[model samples]
Target: MLSKKERAEEDALVEEELQAMGPKGLLGMFSTKGAKKKPKLFLELSKAQQRVQGKNSLVLRQLDGDTMSDKLSTYKKTIRFHILAAHDEAITMVKELRGLRQDVNARDEKGRSALHFACRMGSEAAIATLIKEEGSVDEPDLEMRWTPLHYAVMGKHKYAAKLLLKYAPSPYVTVNRRDKIGTTPLMIAAAEGHASIVRFLLDSSADINDRDTYLISQGMTALHYAALTDQVKSVEVLLEYKAKVEIRTKASGETALELAERLGSHLVSVALFECK
Candidate 1:
């Protein structure tokens, strides 16, 4: 073992390296930024209609809408500031809007607010400014009952999620809150193979065995989804966090281990067997 001074020096080096990597750190490498990006998912719609939603199009003020006149709604234009991370513009407009005592959380046709757009953009500075302006942290869009935290995690915006967890009013209120589909942020992170997010949510005391209702009758836990989707690291982390291994699916009555076996996910199956 090194002396205390040497250990402190080593610790400082690690912290410096992380900060040098910017807001994303190690998780940045695994983010869905390029070809690895998957389809957009949120307050999920029917399977067929789900494809229509974009990863960032939470608002319904479409560019191609029939009423594409210059007189677009104020909220729609303001949301653009958040999406574009126009800090100076956002600050000026938001201050002006506040002076008029307007609703910062005003919803577009799809119930999305500027705050929602900020979260989707993963602009931590923009999100912090909006939250400081009294933006509602737990507001839901028409797409689903997803909170800003949900969007942050789903977008692989770890910095945004960190800010929300620290500053949002009662992180517990929305930390585990389920969407219309009963999917929690933890469940979404697992299915998408977001191992770092899985670790963060687990550390934040997210329910390790929380259940969700999918499109059909399947009542699945985070582990079930991880196993079914071949998220090997997610399976290991869930089991390590003491997630229930005995929980069975509501429809097929399959446990996570069984699901992994069925999908020929040998690595996940091996991890589950060790859990058993």
Candidate 2:
């Protein structure tokens, strides 16, 4: 074992190496004018370190007077910020830190998991890494009961969605697996007119007629959601899957065709009417 002075010197060297490999340095590798550009992730990483170190540890060491939990909360925030900002290197570093017992599962004030942030930023690689690390894909944020899949759809990130589906399938992929409006993955895809996703989900054996008790009545199906949104293609896809055309909502007591007509989606109305 090294003497106290030698150990201190070794620790100083390790800290210097870490700082050199940090976000600011990583940015320099991308942009020649990085110093002029001011990478926000560098600042976030600094905040994260302060958070991981905890104020209480500093106080206990007689170095400062801050609390441990407070510092940890701040670190969690920084981890989220880096994930949201699409800082791939930063995310890698954070995961490594978390693997070293830095608390990777920490949630932000919004209750969004890091996987949600990767989806929001359309970072497929980061998302893939998180999923491989067995990160929670089912966590909901503050709003929309939105999971990573919800963010992927809203952000229009096909690749990120694809990555998620590859690593973790829906229903099994999302927690409570329900949207804020109480819709499922198939329901959200239908409502948003995402025909491809609709088709994929249907092919994946997602229940074509799953209905949420909170938003609509028990009888409503994916076709009902599709027709309501005037998504003609979605309606056709559901119909092709043998979805019940005559399904009705408890609140509206209207068939898919009737709802389609009300929404002025003539194609969907016509298709539903033609359905057996």
Candidate 3:
């Protein structure tokens, strides 16, 4: 029979072999005659299990984060689709999504918000809903930097414009906000021949003689746009609102009357001349 020291040395060797084989070898020890020899192998197995559990937990958390991100993206797309549809059911869907805490002010690829599309489409109900939900009114698109008020005026949606003006956090900022080319809502209204919108903008204290920063339209006011576009009624409205007809283009130094005459806008030219 081996001495006590010899048996102890043999136990140490077996333990070293089990550790080198890892948790799998520990399981094999259970089926062997050496199973009962070492009780410390159970501790090694427990440590291996703990490591696997930790890795699994990290993977689960990452999946949850991805799921939340996907839901938010889908919600944004659905809201935009509803705004484009501009019907009662679509508006209802938007409201439902908003009630679920979805972002009402989420922008599309063009950086346009729901309020911007609502105003552009002249959806009065959608506009009211988004406004009541506290969506931004003065948010500008990435491309044109146009606010909701700009779209309303451009579309000649009088009531839509009224709603935006009424609910705007800052009436002056919304009314006088400029686009990428430095054209204000008033300038768009005048150029589009939207006489009513032009008048409303003027009454709302829009800058009547605001000039654009574009090369061709530089230093041109709402009056110049109306005159050049042959917008007779818009010209009349601007004149009634006391738009400065004396304002001249930067490059051409031509006043609204001169541009009107050169463009052959007979009615607008006559209006500008009379105003002068």
| lDDT score, candidate 1, position 14 | 45
Local accuracy of candidate 3 as per-residue lDDT tens digits, 1-276: 344585456445545654555665522322345565654322243435533432444322232123433332343343334334244234664656567745666664345666776776688887888788777888897767988898788667999999988988889888999888889999999999998889888999898888998865478899888887889999998888788888889979999999988988888888888766
Candidate 3 least-lDDT 10 residues: 57-66
Q: Residue 2: error of model 2 in Å? A: 27
Which residue pairs collide in model 2, if any?
55-66, 56-67, 138-175, 144-180
lDDT of 1 by residue, 1-276 (tens): 245585456445544544554665421323356656554222123423432443244453443334322112233343334333422246654665668634567565456666676676677666877778788888876758778878888788877888887886787766788887989989989998988989998888788898997776788999998998999998888888999999999999999999989989999999999878
**Pick by lDDT: 1 or 2, better one:** 1
Residue-by-residue lDDT tens digits, candidate 2, 184-234: 778878878888877777666677777776644455677888887888888
Best first by TM-score, ranked: 3, 1, 2
Top-down lDDT ranking: 3, 1, 2
Which structure is stronger by lDDT: 2 or 3? Answer: 3
Candidate 3: residue 81 Cα off by (Å) = 4.7
- Candidate 3: list runs displaced more than 4 Å: 1-85, 88-94
- Please, what is the TM-score per model? 0.70, 0.66, 0.71
Count of steric clashes across candidates, in order: 1, 4, 0
